[model samples]
Target: MRILLVLFLLAVGCAGRDDGEGVSTQRERDSVVGASNLPGASGVRGALRAADSANARHGRLDSAGP
Candidate 1:
């Protein structure tokens, strides 16, 4: 009875603690560029432009292939 109560309390405490592995440092997070970093329609346009530029560059290389 008391042993079961103690076990339950231990489990509850452990579940709420962060083991530190899930946390990201400021520098680590800053190095990532995700969609959340961009704001509205302009962000979408910027992403499309970058994709198009990459595709054009790839096409140029492929055209020169053996």
Candidate 2:
């Protein structure tokens, strides 16, 4: 039937729209990479170091007696 044909076409068309923008942004990432390579990487390394410190602090707190 024509109704079934239209419904099938609609379903197929809708299914292809979720392909996640269909392009790799990595190829365009060269410009920003050098910026992150600068002195101390502008707190990026510090941020990761802070994560470990925070986890350690939380572990200490969790183990302390009330």
Candidate 3:
């Protein structure tokens, strides 16, 4: 029936649209990532910082050569 066809089309359209529930904005992401209480968070910025610190601690990134 046309009614069932219309309902199916509407459901398909809704399913195709993303409501952005789990996605975080840059600021919100920054706030959580910037909180140092989280140890070794997988955020890009945090991971980079952690890598830099680890390299520095191990003398791996020194210009004088490892």
Tell me the whole-model lDDT of each prediction, alpha carbons only. 0.70, 0.67, 0.72
Please, what are the lDDT tens digits per residue for candidate 2 over residues 1-66? 999999999999888556577654642343244357676555655565576799999999999969
Q: Which ten residues in a row have the lowest lDDT in candidate 1?
A: 26-35
Over 4 Å off, model 3: 1-42, 60-66
C-alpha TM-score for every candidate: 0.39, 0.38, 0.27
Off by over 4 Å in 2: 1-42
Better of 2 and 3 by TM-score: 2
Best-performing candidate as measured by lDDT: 3
Q: Model 3, range 1-66, lDDT digits (tens) per residue?
A: 999999999998888657678877775676677665675555756666776788797785466683
The full ranking of all candidates by lDDT, starting with the best, is 3, 1, 2
Q: List pairs with backbone clashes in candidate 2.
A: none
In order, how many clashes per candidate? Answer: 0, 0, 0
TM-score of 2: 0.38
What count of clashes does model 2 give? Answer: 0
Candidates 1 and 2, the one with greater lDDT: 1
Query: Residue 50 in candidate 3 has what lDDT?
Result: 78
Q: For residue 20, give model 1's deviation from the true position in Å.
A: 49
